[model samples]
Target: MSTTTYAVLVLIGILFFVAMDLGKRDKGNDVITLISDDDDQEEHS
Candidate 1:
């Protein structure tokens, strides 16, 4: 196949996968979870 044809095919494949990925639904905010510990321990006299 010609280089142009190959390029077009690759581009279409990439676009198709991207579309499918975007169409997918995520369950929720499962991408990342933040846990912070702001409490500090101090010694009392």
Candidate 2:
């Protein structure tokens, strides 16, 4: 296989492991959210 092929294979393996690790951490299937301050809302009023 060429260098590019090897690099792609390695990337795929890394992504697979990362996905599995993330899946294992799930509990009760809860959704995670990022809350931002409503600074713009205050300024517009």
Clashing pairs in 1: none
lDDT score at residue 15, model 2, on the 0-100 scale: 100
- The number of the candidate with the highest lDDT is 2
Report the C-alpha displacement of residue 45, candidate 1, in angstroms: 68
State the TM-score for model 1.
0.52
lDDT of each: 0.59, 0.69
Give all candidate RMSDs, comma-separated.
Answer: 8.5, 6.5
Misplaced by over 4 Å in model 2 are 27-45
Location of the lowest summed lDDT over 10 successive residues in candidate 1: 32-41
- The residue pairs that clash in candidate 2, if any, are none
- Flag regions of model 1 displaced more than 4 Å: 26-45
Compute the lDDT for candidate 1: 0.59
lDDT of 2 at 44: 75
